[model samples]
Target chain A: MTRIAEKFVEEFYNSFTSEVLTAADPAEVVDRYYAAEAVQIADGIEIDRDKLIAHLRPVRKNLVSWRYEVHEAVREQEQLAARFTIHAQLRKGRMLSTEVHLFAEFAPDGRLRRATQLTRDVTPQTPQDVTPQTTEAAPQ
Target chain B: MTSRELRVLGMTCAHCVNFVTEELEHLPGATAVTVDLPTGTVTITSDQDLGLPQLQAAIEEAGYDLAD
Candidate 1:
Protein backbone atom coordinates (compact mmCIF):
# COMPACT_ATOMS: atom_id res chain seq x y z
CA MET A 1 0.00 0.00 0.00
CA THR A 2 1.17 3.49 -0.69
CA ARG A 3 1.61 5.86 2.24
CA ILE A 4 -1.64 7.55 1.37
CA ALA A 5 -3.52 4.28 1.17
CA GLU A 6 -2.08 3.14 4.45
CA LYS A 7 -3.03 6.42 6.04
CA PHE A 8 -6.60 6.09 4.85
CA VAL A 9 -6.80 2.51 6.11
CA GLU A 10 -5.48 3.48 9.50
CA GLU A 11 -7.94 6.29 9.87
CA PHE A 12 -10.86 4.18 8.70
CA TYR A 13 -10.12 1.31 11.02
CA ASN A 14 -9.37 3.52 14.00
CA SER A 15 -12.41 5.67 13.58
CA PHE A 16 -14.66 2.71 12.86
CA THR A 17 -13.68 1.13 16.15
CA SER A 18 -13.41 4.24 18.28
CA GLU A 19 -16.43 6.10 17.07
CA VAL A 20 -18.74 3.14 16.72
CA LEU A 21 -17.89 1.20 19.82
CA THR A 22 -16.32 3.88 22.03
CA ALA A 23 -18.85 6.65 21.56
CA ALA A 24 -16.42 8.98 19.87
CA ASP A 25 -18.00 11.36 17.41
CA PRO A 26 -17.79 11.20 13.64
CA ALA A 27 -15.65 14.31 13.46
CA GLU A 28 -13.11 12.63 15.63
CA VAL A 29 -13.20 9.59 13.39
CA VAL A 30 -12.90 11.78 10.33
CA ASP A 31 -10.29 14.12 11.73
CA ARG A 32 -8.18 11.43 13.24
CA TYR A 33 -8.64 8.27 11.18
CA TYR A 34 -10.96 8.10 8.14
CA ALA A 35 -10.82 9.37 4.62
CA ALA A 36 -13.82 11.45 3.61
CA GLU A 37 -15.25 8.81 1.28
CA ALA A 38 -14.62 5.66 3.26
CA VAL A 39 -17.29 2.99 3.02
CA GLN A 40 -18.22 0.27 5.52
CA ILE A 41 -19.51 -3.27 5.26
CA ALA A 42 -20.53 -5.39 8.23
CA ASP A 43 -22.52 -8.54 7.82
CA GLY A 44 -24.48 -7.84 4.65
CA ILE A 45 -25.07 -4.17 5.31
CA GLU A 46 -23.12 -1.55 3.45
CA ILE A 47 -22.86 2.09 4.39
CA ASP A 48 -21.29 5.20 3.00
CA ARG A 49 -19.49 7.74 5.14
CA ASP A 50 -22.50 9.42 6.67
CA LYS A 51 -24.47 6.24 7.10
CA LEU A 52 -21.47 4.45 8.51
CA ILE A 53 -21.12 6.95 11.30
CA ALA A 54 -24.79 6.70 12.07
CA HIS A 55 -24.66 2.92 12.12
CA LEU A 56 -21.78 2.96 14.56
CA ARG A 57 -23.50 5.24 17.05
CA PRO A 58 -26.10 2.75 18.24
CA VAL A 59 -23.68 -0.13 18.35
CA ARG A 60 -21.16 1.83 20.39
CA LYS A 61 -23.42 1.76 23.44
CA ASN A 62 -22.88 -1.95 24.09
CA LEU A 63 -19.13 -1.69 24.30
CA VAL A 64 -16.91 -0.41 27.07
CA SER A 65 -13.48 -0.45 25.52
CA TRP A 66 -12.65 -1.86 22.08
CA ARG A 67 -9.16 -2.12 20.68
CA TYR A 68 -7.37 -4.06 17.95
CA GLU A 69 -3.87 -5.33 17.25
CA VAL A 70 -2.90 -5.88 13.65
CA HIS A 71 -1.11 -9.11 12.82
CA GLU A 72 -0.57 -8.57 9.12
CA ALA A 73 -1.46 -6.18 6.34
CA VAL A 74 -1.18 -7.10 2.69
CA ARG A 75 -1.89 -4.97 -0.33
CA GLU A 76 -2.55 -6.10 -3.90
CA GLN A 77 -2.99 -3.36 -6.40
CA GLU A 78 -6.01 -1.34 -5.29
CA GLN A 79 -7.11 -3.90 -2.72
CA LEU A 80 -5.82 -4.26 0.83
CA ALA A 81 -6.35 -6.99 3.35
CA ALA A 82 -5.71 -6.41 7.05
CA ARG A 83 -5.77 -9.19 9.55
CA PHE A 84 -6.00 -8.38 13.25
CA THR A 85 -7.58 -9.05 16.62
CA ILE A 86 -9.88 -7.03 18.77
CA HIS A 87 -10.28 -7.19 22.54
CA ALA A 88 -13.35 -5.68 24.06
CA GLN A 89 -15.65 -5.68 27.09
CA LEU A 90 -19.40 -5.38 26.94
CA ARG A 91 -21.70 -3.47 29.25
CA LYS A 92 -22.92 -6.75 30.70
CA GLY A 93 -19.55 -7.57 32.17
CA ARG A 94 -18.67 -9.86 29.32
CA MET A 95 -15.21 -9.79 27.83
CA LEU A 96 -14.31 -11.03 24.36
CA SER A 97 -11.30 -11.14 22.10
CA THR A 98 -11.36 -12.07 18.44
CA GLU A 99 -9.56 -11.97 15.10
CA VAL A 100 -10.82 -10.39 11.92
CA HIS A 101 -9.94 -10.12 8.27
CA LEU A 102 -10.60 -6.79 6.64
CA PHE A 103 -10.81 -6.26 2.88
CA ALA A 104 -10.27 -2.71 1.74
CA GLU A 105 -10.35 -1.10 -1.66
CA PHE A 106 -9.01 2.24 -2.87
CA ALA A 107 -10.46 4.62 -5.39
CA PRO A 108 -8.61 5.99 -8.39
CA ASP A 109 -7.88 9.17 -6.47
CA GLY A 110 -6.25 7.15 -3.64
CA ARG A 111 -9.26 7.63 -1.38
CA LEU A 112 -10.96 4.76 0.39
CA ARG A 113 -13.79 3.23 -1.56
CA ARG A 114 -14.89 0.41 0.70
CA ALA A 115 -13.96 -1.73 3.67
CA THR A 116 -15.41 -5.12 4.56
CA GLN A 117 -15.09 -6.76 7.97
CA LEU A 118 -15.13 -10.51 8.70
CA THR A 119 -14.51 -11.85 12.17
CA ARG A 120 -13.78 -14.91 14.31
CA ASP A 121 -13.98 -14.97 18.12
CA VAL A 122 -11.08 -15.82 20.40
CA THR A 123 -10.66 -16.14 24.15
CA PRO A 124 -7.97 -15.34 26.66
CA GLN A 125 -6.26 -18.48 27.85
CA THR A 126 -3.01 -19.73 29.30
CA PRO A 127 -0.39 -21.24 27.05
CA GLN A 128 -1.36 -24.62 28.46
CA ASP A 129 -4.78 -24.20 26.89
CA VAL A 130 -3.60 -24.11 23.30
CA THR A 131 -0.51 -26.26 23.41
CA PRO A 132 -0.89 -29.95 22.72
CA GLN A 133 0.88 -32.34 25.06
CA THR A 134 2.48 -35.20 23.22
CA THR A 135 4.26 -36.49 26.31
CA GLU A 136 2.19 -38.93 28.27
CA ALA A 137 2.91 -40.11 31.77
CA ALA A 138 4.63 -43.47 31.92
CA PRO A 139 2.26 -46.27 32.89
CA GLN A 140 2.41 -46.35 36.66
CA MET B 1 -13.11 -35.66 16.65
CA THR B 2 -15.84 -34.03 14.58
CA SER B 3 -15.99 -30.77 12.69
CA ARG B 4 -18.90 -28.50 11.97
CA GLU B 5 -19.42 -25.17 10.27
CA LEU B 6 -21.07 -22.25 12.03
CA ARG B 7 -22.07 -18.81 10.90
CA VAL B 8 -21.57 -15.99 13.35
CA LEU B 9 -24.03 -13.10 13.23
CA GLY B 10 -23.21 -9.41 13.60
CA MET B 11 -19.57 -9.87 12.79
CA THR B 12 -17.79 -7.26 10.73
CA CYS B 13 -14.06 -6.63 10.51
CA ALA B 14 -10.92 -8.33 11.65
CA HIS B 15 -11.66 -7.78 15.31
CA CYS B 16 -14.85 -9.77 15.20
CA VAL B 17 -13.08 -12.75 13.68
CA ASN B 18 -10.32 -12.51 16.27
CA PHE B 19 -12.75 -12.40 19.15
CA VAL B 20 -14.68 -15.48 18.03
CA THR B 21 -11.62 -17.54 17.14
CA GLU B 22 -9.97 -16.78 20.48
CA GLU B 23 -13.03 -17.62 22.56
CA LEU B 24 -13.92 -20.86 20.78
CA GLU B 25 -10.37 -22.17 20.75
CA HIS B 26 -10.29 -21.86 24.53
CA LEU B 27 -13.10 -24.32 24.95
CA PRO B 28 -12.14 -27.63 26.57
CA GLY B 29 -12.19 -29.74 23.45
CA ALA B 30 -11.66 -27.36 20.57
CA THR B 31 -8.73 -28.51 18.50
CA ALA B 32 -8.78 -25.92 15.78
CA VAL B 33 -10.85 -23.03 14.49
CA THR B 34 -10.93 -21.64 10.99
CA VAL B 35 -12.80 -18.63 9.71
CA ASP B 36 -13.48 -17.73 6.09
CA LEU B 37 -14.03 -14.03 5.52
CA PRO B 38 -16.09 -13.98 2.35
CA THR B 39 -18.22 -16.92 3.44
CA GLY B 40 -18.67 -15.81 7.06
CA THR B 41 -18.34 -19.37 8.20
CA VAL B 42 -16.45 -20.70 11.21
CA THR B 43 -15.20 -24.24 11.01
CA ILE B 44 -14.27 -25.95 14.27
CA THR B 45 -12.43 -29.15 15.02
CA SER B 46 -12.54 -30.92 18.37
CA ASP B 47 -11.52 -34.23 19.86
CA GLN B 48 -14.28 -34.41 22.44
CA ASP B 49 -17.93 -33.57 22.71
CA LEU B 50 -18.73 -29.88 22.46
CA GLY B 51 -21.84 -28.20 23.70
CA LEU B 52 -23.87 -25.56 21.94
CA PRO B 53 -24.57 -23.60 25.12
CA GLN B 54 -20.93 -22.90 25.66
CA LEU B 55 -20.49 -21.78 22.09
CA GLN B 56 -23.66 -19.73 22.21
CA ALA B 57 -22.65 -17.95 25.40
CA ALA B 58 -19.27 -17.08 24.02
CA ILE B 59 -20.74 -15.77 20.81
CA GLU B 60 -23.29 -13.66 22.65
CA GLU B 61 -20.62 -12.35 24.95
CA ALA B 62 -18.70 -11.32 21.91
CA GLY B 63 -21.76 -9.29 20.92
CA TYR B 64 -22.80 -11.66 18.15
CA ASP B 65 -25.04 -14.68 17.73
CA LEU B 66 -24.83 -18.05 16.07
CA ALA B 67 -26.89 -17.90 12.96
CA ASP B 68 -29.54 -20.54 12.42
Candidate 2:
Protein backbone atom coordinates (compact mmCIF):
# COMPACT_ATOMS: atom_id res chain seq x y z
CA MET A 1 0.00 0.00 0.00
CA THR A 2 2.82 2.36 0.85
CA ARG A 3 4.64 1.70 -2.38
CA ILE A 4 1.46 2.07 -4.36
CA ALA A 5 0.70 5.37 -2.68
CA GLU A 6 4.18 6.66 -3.32
CA LYS A 7 4.04 5.59 -6.94
CA PHE A 8 0.70 7.28 -7.38
CA VAL A 9 1.97 10.51 -5.90
CA GLU A 10 5.03 10.49 -8.15
CA GLU A 11 3.12 9.66 -11.29
CA PHE A 12 0.30 12.09 -10.54
CA TYR A 13 2.59 15.09 -10.08
CA ASN A 14 4.90 14.09 -12.89
CA SER A 15 2.07 13.82 -15.34
CA PHE A 16 0.12 16.79 -14.01
CA THR A 17 3.05 19.19 -14.15
CA SER A 18 4.26 18.01 -17.55
CA GLU A 19 0.90 18.00 -19.22
CA VAL A 20 -0.45 21.18 -17.69
CA LEU A 21 2.61 23.16 -18.60
CA THR A 22 2.68 21.98 -22.21
CA ALA A 23 -0.73 20.69 -23.21
CA ALA A 24 -2.72 22.57 -25.79
CA ASP A 25 -5.74 22.42 -23.48
CA PRO A 26 -4.54 22.45 -19.93
CA ALA A 27 -8.14 22.29 -18.66
CA GLU A 28 -8.37 18.77 -19.97
CA VAL A 29 -5.39 17.82 -17.90
CA VAL A 30 -7.00 19.30 -14.80
CA ASP A 31 -10.27 17.50 -15.46
CA ARG A 32 -8.45 14.23 -15.93
CA TYR A 33 -7.00 14.24 -12.44
CA TYR A 34 -9.75 16.06 -10.58
CA ALA A 35 -13.34 15.05 -10.27
CA ALA A 36 -16.15 17.38 -11.31
CA GLU A 37 -16.76 18.32 -7.71
CA ALA A 38 -13.17 18.53 -6.70
CA VAL A 39 -11.97 21.33 -4.49
CA GLN A 40 -8.43 22.32 -3.64
CA ILE A 41 -7.25 24.60 -0.89
CA ALA A 42 -3.72 25.91 -0.99
CA ASP A 43 -2.61 27.97 1.95
CA GLY A 44 -6.24 28.61 2.90
CA ILE A 45 -7.36 29.87 -0.49
CA GLU A 46 -10.04 27.74 -2.09
CA ILE A 47 -9.71 26.79 -5.73
CA ASP A 48 -12.45 25.15 -7.66
CA ARG A 49 -12.22 23.73 -11.18
CA ASP A 50 -12.60 27.05 -12.95
CA LYS A 51 -10.09 28.70 -10.66
CA LEU A 52 -7.64 25.90 -11.27
CA ILE A 53 -7.92 26.28 -15.02
CA ALA A 54 -7.49 30.01 -14.73
CA HIS A 55 -4.36 29.59 -12.61
CA LEU A 56 -2.88 27.21 -15.17
CA ARG A 57 -2.89 29.75 -17.97
CA PRO A 58 -0.11 31.87 -16.53
CA VAL A 59 1.78 28.79 -15.42
CA ARG A 60 1.76 27.35 -18.93
CA LYS A 61 2.91 30.64 -20.32
CA ASN A 62 5.70 31.47 -17.89
CA LEU A 63 6.87 28.13 -16.60
CA VAL A 64 9.93 26.85 -18.44
CA SER A 65 10.60 23.57 -16.69
CA TRP A 66 9.76 21.82 -13.47
CA ARG A 67 10.21 18.60 -11.50
CA TYR A 68 9.13 17.13 -8.21
CA GLU A 69 11.14 15.41 -5.52
CA VAL A 70 8.86 13.33 -3.33
CA HIS A 71 10.27 12.93 0.14
CA GLU A 72 7.51 10.74 1.51
CA ALA A 73 4.00 9.56 0.65
CA VAL A 74 1.45 7.45 2.43
CA ARG A 75 -2.09 6.26 2.00
CA GLU A 76 -4.81 5.18 4.36
CA GLN A 77 -7.96 4.11 2.50
CA GLU A 78 -9.01 6.84 0.10
CA GLN A 79 -6.87 9.50 1.75
CA LEU A 80 -3.37 10.19 0.48
CA ALA A 81 -0.70 12.41 1.97
CA ALA A 82 2.63 13.46 0.56
CA ARG A 83 5.59 15.69 1.24
CA PHE A 84 7.49 16.92 -1.79
CA THR A 85 9.51 19.73 -3.25
CA ILE A 86 8.99 21.41 -6.59
CA HIS A 87 11.89 22.96 -8.45
CA ALA A 88 10.49 25.14 -11.18
CA GLN A 89 12.40 27.33 -13.56
CA LEU A 90 10.57 30.22 -15.10
CA ARG A 91 11.22 32.50 -18.01
CA LYS A 92 13.99 35.10 -17.77
CA GLY A 93 16.05 33.08 -15.33
CA ARG A 94 13.61 33.04 -12.45
CA MET A 95 13.51 29.94 -10.28
CA LEU A 96 11.21 28.77 -7.51
CA SER A 97 11.81 25.96 -5.06
CA THR A 98 8.91 25.16 -2.79
CA GLU A 99 8.36 22.49 -0.20
CA VAL A 100 4.78 21.24 -0.27
CA HIS A 101 2.73 19.18 2.08
CA LEU A 102 -0.33 17.79 0.35
CA PHE A 103 -3.28 15.81 1.56
CA ALA A 104 -5.96 14.51 -0.78
CA GLU A 105 -9.01 12.34 -1.02
CA PHE A 106 -9.83 10.26 -4.05
CA ALA A 107 -13.22 9.55 -5.46
CA PRO A 108 -14.44 6.06 -6.25
CA ASP A 109 -13.40 6.52 -9.87
CA GLY A 110 -9.85 7.46 -8.84
CA ARG A 111 -10.12 11.16 -9.52
CA LEU A 112 -9.25 13.60 -6.79
CA ARG A 113 -12.22 14.72 -4.76
CA ARG A 114 -10.57 17.14 -2.40
CA ALA A 115 -7.10 18.33 -1.58
CA THR A 116 -5.32 20.67 0.80
CA GLN A 117 -1.81 21.91 0.42
CA LEU A 118 0.58 23.81 2.63
CA THR A 119 3.66 25.26 0.97
CA ARG A 120 6.69 27.31 1.90
CA ASP A 121 9.39 28.70 -0.34
CA VAL A 122 12.84 27.20 0.08
CA THR A 123 16.08 28.47 -1.37
CA PRO A 124 17.50 26.10 -3.92
CA GLN A 125 20.96 24.84 -3.09
CA THR A 126 22.02 25.28 -6.72
CA PRO A 127 19.88 27.77 -8.56
CA GLN A 128 21.83 27.21 -11.77
CA ASP A 129 20.87 23.55 -11.92
CA VAL A 130 17.57 22.98 -13.69
CA THR A 131 15.82 20.34 -15.68
CA PRO A 132 15.99 20.41 -19.46
CA GLN A 133 13.71 22.94 -21.05
CA THR A 134 10.35 21.86 -22.39
CA THR A 135 9.25 22.16 -26.02
CA GLU A 136 7.29 25.28 -25.18
CA ALA A 137 9.21 28.37 -26.14
CA ALA A 138 10.10 30.99 -23.57
CA PRO A 139 8.88 34.55 -24.00
CA GLN A 140 11.22 36.63 -26.15
CA MET B 1 4.47 20.13 33.21
CA THR B 2 6.61 21.65 30.55
CA SER B 3 4.93 22.97 27.42
CA ARG B 4 6.84 23.01 24.19
CA GLU B 5 5.67 24.70 21.04
CA LEU B 6 7.04 23.70 17.66
CA ARG B 7 6.39 24.63 14.10
CA VAL B 8 6.10 21.56 11.96
CA LEU B 9 6.28 21.61 8.22
CA GLY B 10 4.33 19.35 5.86
CA MET B 11 1.16 18.87 7.83
CA THR B 12 -1.82 19.81 5.71
CA CYS B 13 -4.84 17.93 6.95
CA ALA B 14 -6.63 16.38 9.85
CA HIS B 15 -4.92 13.10 9.22
CA CYS B 16 -1.58 14.78 9.49
CA VAL B 17 -2.66 16.45 12.72
CA ASN B 18 -3.76 13.13 14.12
CA PHE B 19 -0.56 11.43 13.08
CA VAL B 20 1.60 14.10 14.65
CA THR B 21 -0.48 14.22 17.80
CA GLU B 22 -0.27 10.48 18.14
CA GLU B 23 3.48 10.47 17.74
CA LEU B 24 4.00 13.21 20.26
CA GLU B 25 1.61 11.62 22.70
CA HIS B 26 3.79 8.54 22.69
CA LEU B 27 6.77 10.38 24.09
CA PRO B 28 7.96 9.35 27.54
CA GLY B 29 6.52 12.27 29.49
CA ALA B 30 4.02 13.73 27.09
CA THR B 31 0.77 14.46 28.90
CA ALA B 32 -1.07 16.34 26.19
CA VAL B 33 -0.61 17.10 22.52
CA THR B 34 -2.28 19.87 20.57
CA VAL B 35 -1.78 20.18 16.84
CA ASP B 36 -3.09 23.03 14.78
CA LEU B 37 -3.33 21.87 11.20
CA PRO B 38 -3.62 25.22 9.48
CA THR B 39 -0.53 26.70 11.10
CA GLY B 40 1.41 23.48 11.57
CA THR B 41 1.88 24.43 15.19
CA VAL B 42 2.13 21.70 17.80
CA THR B 43 2.05 22.26 21.54
CA ILE B 44 3.10 19.38 23.68
CA THR B 45 2.66 19.26 27.42
CA SER B 46 5.07 16.92 29.07
CA ASP B 47 6.59 16.27 32.46
CA GLN B 48 10.18 16.60 31.23
CA ASP B 49 11.97 18.84 28.80
CA LEU B 50 12.06 17.07 25.45
CA GLY B 51 15.24 17.65 23.52
CA LEU B 52 15.30 18.82 19.94
CA PRO B 53 16.47 15.43 18.74
CA GLN B 54 13.61 13.72 20.53
CA LEU B 55 11.03 16.08 19.07
CA GLN B 56 12.57 15.84 15.62
CA ALA B 57 12.56 12.08 15.78
CA ALA B 58 8.90 11.98 16.72
CA ILE B 59 7.88 14.41 14.00
CA GLU B 60 10.03 12.64 11.41
CA GLU B 61 8.50 9.36 12.41
CA ALA B 62 5.14 10.87 11.55
CA GLY B 63 6.49 11.79 8.07
CA TYR B 64 6.89 15.50 8.76
CA ASP B 65 9.68 17.94 9.52
CA LEU B 66 10.40 20.80 11.87
CA ALA B 67 10.51 24.25 10.37
CA ASP B 68 13.99 25.76 10.60
**Which candidate number would show the highest lDDT if scored against the true structure?**
2
**How high is the CA lDDT of each candidate model?**
0.62, 0.76
Candidate 1: segments with Cα more than 4 A from true spot:
A1-21, A24-38, A41-140
Here the TM-score of candidate 1's chain B is 0.87
**Highest TM-score scorer:** 2
Listed in order, the DockQ scores are: 0.10, 0.02
Give candidate 2 misplaced runs (Cα > 4 Å).
Answer: A133-140, B1-68
- Model 2, range A7-109, lDDT digits (tens) per residue? 7786777777777876889888888888999999987867788877766654555557777778889989789999988776764455667788999999887
lDDT of 2 at B22: 65
Q: lDDT of model 1 at residue B63?
A: 56
Candidate 1: tens digits of C-alpha lDDT, residues A1-140 = 45544444444555455544443365454433445777777655565666555434334545556555567777777788887766666544456666777888877655567788866667576211211112221110
User: For all the candidates, what are their Cα RMSDs to the real structure?
Assistant: 13.0, 14.0
Give the number of the best model, judged by DockQ.
1
